[model samples]
Target: MKTIKKLSLLSLMSLSGLGLAQYTPQWTEAPQQIDLVDMTSFKSISQPVNSEQQAVRFHYSLLGSDQLSDNNQGYLAESKQYWLNTNAQKLSQGLQLPVTSDLAVIRINPLNPTKSSQSLNQQDITVQQFDQTLSVDVFADSEQLKATGMPVSDYTVAFNVHTQPGMLTLSMPTATKALAKGDTFIIHVFEPNSEYVLQLKTSQQQYAANQVVKINSQLLSQSGVNHMTIAGYITQPNGEKLTDLSFQQNKNGDYQATIGQLTGQSLAHGLWEVHTIASSDINGLKVMRDVSTAFALSLPTARINQQLAVQSHGLKLGLDVAAAGRYEVSAVLSGINAQGEKQPIAMLMSAAQLNKGQADLTLDLPQDLIRQSGFKGPFVVDHISLKNQSLMVPVQQLSAGIQLMPLGKPMDQDDLR
Candidate 1:
């Protein structure tokens, strides 16, 4: 009676396609650490964008002495600019001038329907500095003045002045010919004394939770004295200041700071920014420079252990998750070929709802897939990884290969069709 019951169970398993051999994987060495910096970080859910509105296209470029010239063919390409038409262009906008005594040139080019880059001589455009009339110069054959898809050569104008620290209001009044709908206005500023520059840099553009972040900064000052004061602070995605960064000057003349290990759950997941400001008295002139840079942060919700085994179902992997979430495990299977070199045979993966702490994640390795490859064991598992599907974050990864002893009939040509 017992013999009959055992036979019945085995037959049931065979019918369900669950009858397979199980074996433990042998490890030749310890697993190596995975580099998350090489992978793309997951992006948060984006907000819905409203339909495009009929408005003027506006852009502004703030350039320094390094970019200004009498006739610049690549002025449009070389200058760093910002697009400000979030909804529509306004008739009047406030323009903040950088603090400098440099020979500054501010150009306001208004776009129109027919000619994308209309010369100031063709349009009655007005610019004011502190509500006063500002003198301007017009250039008729500036070839690089055209907007995208426009003719290569177009006419434009710029207002040049030896400026002190102040603000200017740029006015593009709406009229029959001066300004039109769906036009583009570009404001370019050139400062001759822009040789003084402050820079900020981070160690990496992305980091995992609980990882230490390093920062280095430097200032190329034309000032005679090193009397400048520089400081910076970090802000969360919400624009709230997280903490002030204290930078210490090193022997290499570089300002450096390190953010202690980020505590999981203490820091928010999103884009974080680092802002720096430097002020100095260069040649008795008060000069100030400020800049900001951003980086992406993510949580390490789970990790994969060195333990690997082959069971009746498939290859089993051990996972240690910090949070309860759906986790995925994948590995590359390689077997020894006739040349005594290990060659890739198959790629396997599996995913399941994993609870916090230790969990067994199995990847299905079909017998037929391996049999057809004609590779012998012991097999090797490489490029293994664990990821949290709920958060869309990579938990861990390993490139070091995991060795496994041969199971029943590691390779059989008879099994091949």
Candidate 2:
């Protein structure tokens, strides 16, 4: 039985050749000590090369702190170097071939003797030859560790070698300002590697409650053009487009438009829909599909401009005119009672010039007319009518001040005598 055991051992050794003995080459005392606390305390050593085949060998030591060592001896009294054939047998049974630096882990417990240290706990350090340089990395168990720390505890360390290529970053542009209803916005995303299709998503806060508004939906072309259409409907009660809506083109090629006059008639109460649709222009045809969000429309107030006031002596006289033009203003004195009935009053004429901001008019009241009518205190100015025009403004509605000047204190005939 002893002879059979010896023969089996010899057969196994012969099959593996003497190279298996060199598989885990032992190392003597290393001269230098490494400090784990210093991250930069790393030393590079050349790996042994196998001439018979493409193989790499790594030998390393883990030293203890000088204060922790007995008799000031290093933590790792002796270390071993391990050889791995890069082109020889496969490291694992299922693997196709051996890589230059394939790492394996082994565990050992110095205190335990019944169990083999190989199965207890162990780490494999691989040295790989890449072109003219060597790469080294360590693997323990199922985890990988760098050579920067000792193997006494569970930790990860990594070592890498490669040429760094230039990098480019892409980012989206910030929104310019608050968007109004029916406004169009363009968004851009930059990428260099390949063309990408992106979909934009907006928050619920962007839309009104219970209102459906279409947000942005569009495809950005490689030319950086975002092709999409956005629109918002005014749904507030009496919501109308603002008057005098205009778009002004600046010297910088920017477009600005005043959202026309808004009236209560155009908008419905509550939430409105403001949406964007992204369409692709296939050939010349447009294919619009996606919709976005619901927005709210607020009611707008009406604006009033032209105003006037008319007064004669102490009684308020309502005057009607025959013609009113852009720059021409005319007023005719007429009689009207509280019942809105026309009474026969002496004909009076007043003239004024009208401009963009304000219209100034002067009414000369004849003393004879005032005296004959026995007009009394503080007369109110009634309606002011433009000559030959339909834009007749009521005197009560006029915002400008109206002054009644008594016709040049009727020239005294006695003074002339």
Candidate 3:
């Protein structure tokens, strides 16, 4: 496997929170650790909603960030800003249905690359334009489950809005073993009686900004000529071309090239597809056909420098937004303790603005929350917000961390003392 493929695949396995992170509100039901059911986890489930509404009320996600490591372990956080810069056409078209996602990252001590640690947590279920009377519930609690790692079935979500009403509710089978297997997704588009078809494949669907998307293409059925060349272009979700992409043919009838570039004109977030116009010589005649295969671009966020200290009147938060402007930040707690008991705790609602895409601000946390939760340890803090004010499709640039303790030198402020 190539390096990029390995990392993105690893992230997919990590539930690296590409689509968004996970959440656990106080009201929702949570799974208990040490309990084993018929299987470890469910990869995919399908059932008609009990009501007319489809799968709108369902709330599910997992939080993954490289931020907490930067705060405590001196590791550099996720490269989200770079991702956005790479895919930058500011365009949103079509009124899709309700899209609601929330990522609340409870820290995972990667000490044992095998064993994952968990703290008790509370999260809210978010639903947009969703008027579904039916609710579908899957396993949302990855931390508290006996099966510690996230299941591949729960990691990815792919859908296509058809030309006609309704959709094909096809779900890939859950991986029987630890490592995921089989074709996770398939979108069947009927193109009958077409000639000179272009088929494209990539390393993976998910990519970070500035990362090269390894691509390979093959013309289905030789154009009846030994010498034929291929060329293509990338179209943004808004129907604008990011730029033109090209490739060279190898001996195996497959042409190889890198599909995307992080130029000023980006491929954009959301869905971007491959449409190719090939000029082929068929029996001394030129023929062309447009190939139809698409992939998605996802943005991962950067880390925020954060810390917590006891204040005389309340809790003081020192924050730093690494890159980009107008990011939303919030903090909360509630997780499993050493005794394996779930302890739901306080929330330090910290939402502040950053100037020049970066700044340092001292904010206040609810003093009452500090006393009630008795939080002397790390506080689970999540920093993420929608891009371009378009709520339907959000560009995720998140920083999830435990800001209170173990990040830096002992609290020097008098408040902690």
> Between prediction 2 and prediction 3, which has the larger TM-score?
3
Write the number of the candidate with greater lDDT, choosing between 2 and 3.
Answer: 3
* Native RMSD of candidate 3 (Å): 26.5
- lDDT (10s digit) by residue, model 3, range 1-417: 598667666655544221111221121222111111111121111111111211111111122211222211111111100000100011011112211112111111122222111211121111112333222233234333425554322222212222221211211111222212221221112223233355567665544444576666665543432345767777765577787777888887677667554311123334666655454555544333345456544332223333434443233333333222333333444343455543434333333334333343333343344344443434443332222111112223333334333334432323222
Error of 2 at 104 (Å): 99
**Positional deviation of 136 in candidate 3, in angstroms?**
46
Q: After superposition, how far is residue 219 of candidate 3 from its true place, in Å?
A: 3.4
Clashes of 1: 0
Q: What is the lDDT of residue 185 in candidate 2?
A: 16
Worst 10 residues of 1 by lDDT: 71-80
Clashes of 3: 17
Score each candidate by Cα lDDT: 0.55, 0.26, 0.34
Please report the candidate that would top TM-score against the real structure. Answer: 1
Best by lDDT: 1
lDDT of 1 at 45: 23
Sliding window of 10 residues with minimal summed lDDT for model 3: 79-88
Off by over 4 Å in 3: 1-197, 204-206, 220-228, 236-238, 259-273, 279-288, 293-417
Residue-level lDDT tens digits of model 1 in 127-162: 555567665554333544454343432444554554
Taking all chains together, each candidate's TM-score versus the true structure is 0.46, 0.16, 0.31
Candidate 1 or 2, higher lDDT?
A: 1
Q: In candidate 2, what are the lDDT values of residues 1-417, reduced to their tens digit?
A: 898767776665453332111111111221111111111221111111111221111111111112111111111111111111211112211111111112222221122222222222212322222222233323243143324344432222223222111111111111112112222211111122222232333222221112232222234445553343323233332233322212233344222222322211112132333332233443443323323233332111111122333233221222232112221222222233444543323333343323233334444334444334443322222222223111221111122212333333333323332
